[model samples]
Target chain A: MKASARLVVGLDPHGNSVVRVLRSQSPLTLVPARRVGPVALVHLVSSVTSPLGGDSLELTVEVGPGASLDLRGVAATLMLPGPTGLPSSSVLRFSVEGSVRYVPEPTVVTSRAHHTAVVEAELDGHAELLLREVLVLGRVGESAGTLSTSVRATRCGKPLLHQQLVVGSPSIDSSAAGLAGKRVVGTSLMLDAVPRASDGGEWWNVVPLAAGGTLATALGDDVVTVTRVLDAI
Target chain B: MLTALILADSRFPGGGHVHSGGLEEAAARGLVTDEPSLKSFLHGRLLTTGLLAAGFAAAAARGEDLELLDAELDARTPSPAQREASRAQGRGMLRAARRAWPSERLAALSRDPHQPLVIGVLVGDPYEAALTCAYLAVSGPASAAVRLLGLDPFGVNAIVAALPVEDVASRAVKELPALGSPALDLLAEAHVRREGVRLFGS
Candidate 1:
């Protein structure tokens, strides 16, 4: 897979901004040729550069004024131990001035696999945003590997949100510090323009941000139901 | 250490007894019918929301920006009911801690400082603050389960004692994530809207 991704937006005085993307050198690359929706889908069919485990990624995505982008993964990222016997990692840095919607597929942690994803986003006050993530601890009839995910976002030099989570190995003794021995966890954070409140039902809970946004967290035994609850709100 | 012990006391007169930490509604939902279930429920809370509070408390003890800490915690806590419960407890606890510890830093804060921040200020150490926060997370619920469910006090005490406090405290000081149990978060909100005999201030 391609090891790195760079997206830089050049703002035009006439208001139309131009975007340029830097491709990865590995098999893990974003398919830029397929242009349709606001999603940036990643392709991980072959990892020749990545000898043992999944390839590591250093990805930076920037959206300039009035230009929006959507980033998504092609499918659930399958975690497998690499040469160093370590899990894959993705470090994402986002600069947003316009609207950006990221609807990625769930990451399914397989046995002995490990993955960590971290996102640090800087947003303008007027920028609209939608961010979603889903994690399935293990695939069908298998034990999940280890996973840690963190997102720290700021808007207009003000603190917006700082959250990190670790979904440990299947051998962990369930605690409030972990996922409580559940198999699935999913979250959606929306900014600037949060949708209207829905009637409370399902396992999803929405908390309106004092900083002007909404955070919805849903938990279930499976992904399909959890995604439904998340999308409904 | 002595002062820290005093702060850790369950009967600190900070109005903690009034908050069951969602045990009231959890009991209503039949989620904590026995000792094992209560153990699981408490574990879910500690790893998710409890650890977040512990990290904040630890961070507060170092005397970082109290206002920023408050804002950071606000983002992590997505349940309005939990937020209100925290603010109310913070206000009450600050009042009590001010009288006991008497610091200018405590005075500078809004009458309501988040519970962990207050713990950090008085305790003055990250590990102590985090452990205190973790302990506070379960102590109230353990006591409440005794009164609400009429369960075996011995079993409840065992559950609380069995918690790997050091492990949890260490992990708490490592990070404060905006993560939570969906069921617990939703239950807290539901507990707020219900009319009649709601036991928890949360």
Candidate 2:
């Protein structure tokens, strides 16, 4: 069970990026991966160096005041199998300070990989944030790996959104319960704002958004809006 | 079995009803209406927003330190209004737990207060707590869907049946994100200000 992980730090808007890579013969630890700045990007990469097994990794993101950070990925993440043929896992902790927003793209898990990822965020007054996550089961014909996810959002030390998901033996077409029997899964949430228009029907409305590539839905005011695409994969 | 049934019940007094789980806003915006549309909307939410919160609850159930859980939830939840809403529901549930469970752990957690914290104290098994949290979160909106859209009760149940609860619970334990969307946070904050809103909380 040999593994390697790299933490890359970047501050967008400033157009500066610094990345740190760490490798472990066993599991990867998050203590070394730290980001500092009003706006910074902490990127991480973990790989099972030894083919005979798999390993687990943990990462944390700490955000300071009035900072705007957008964490994007170079590619979809691939989770390898362990020596026992189970998927490896990762945990993410986001520590937020005054008025900073952290947005990261969704995560994709390759086939036959069994992994779980948890994300927790703590916020303060006058602070803001945005989060987006996506998970893919398998590659082509091979068994799409299983992925489990959980997310928590808080303000002034309280809980906002706590969510979890587990997808096992994912297939291209699943039933309503199984990705609604769809292939790709995505969701977006906007916290406390009133909707500009309620004419659509309930407080929430869905817009086609760009003919086909994007599908957007407006929920509540704007504080809590969700946009998702199963076909987006 | 009893724990499963009690926790799974919509009327468990968990204060879950107060939250539309973003459904109120989604429906108000007309993203969801009637049964099928509500099902689709909820399915999307369960995978995304709902998944995130459920994960926190599951982690809390796993007995991660309370202060650590508190810090994590703060970072994940970006909206001020949403934060109030979660704490409101958590506080409400804690009050209810005192009357229902009344265990020392529940009592201690209630003193400080948070939904996941209270749940962690009450539930002995991490998996069971995850299931309970997911059940409460998902079903709250399902019930709201019926009233908001006047959907058929049977169809609502059908949709509920289609939702992957176990999957949601397990996933909640794994793969949840820690990013906040400003666009949505702003909306939720505004939603909380509305005085005549029909929902329980913001």
Best by DockQ: 1
Two-chain DockQ for each candidate model: 0.50, 0.08
TM-score per model over all chains: 0.89, 0.51
The per-residue C-alpha lDDT of model 2 at residue A216 equals 24
lDDT of 1 by residue, A58-108 (tens): 778788777766665566666667766756787888889887778777878
lDDT of 2 by residue, A36-137 (tens): 554444333333231222455555555455454455443445565665885566666666553333334344456666777777767666555555555444
Model 1 lDDT, residue B106, Cα: 81
Q: Scoring only the second chain, what is candidate 2's TM-score?
A: 0.85
Q: For model 1, how does the per-residue alpha-carbon lDDT over B48-146 read when each residue is reduced to its tens digit?
A: 677778888888887789998898888777677787888887877888887788988887676767788888888888888889888888888888899
Docking class of 2: incorrect
Residue B191's lDDT in candidate 1: 77
Highest-lDDT candidate: 1
Badly placed stretches (over 4 Å) of model 2 are A1-233, B110-112, B174-187, B193-196
lDDT (Cα, tens digit) per residue for candidate 2, span B1-202: 4654665676777666667765665567665667766776556555555565667766766666766666556545544456667788778777776777776556555344556556655666666776676666667778887877788989898888888878877776764445333224434544565457566464
Q: How close is candidate 2 to the true structure, as a TM-score?
A: 0.51
Task: Estimate every model's Cα lDDT from 0 to 1.
Answer: 0.73, 0.54
| Residue A221 CA displacement from its true place in model 1, Å | 2.5
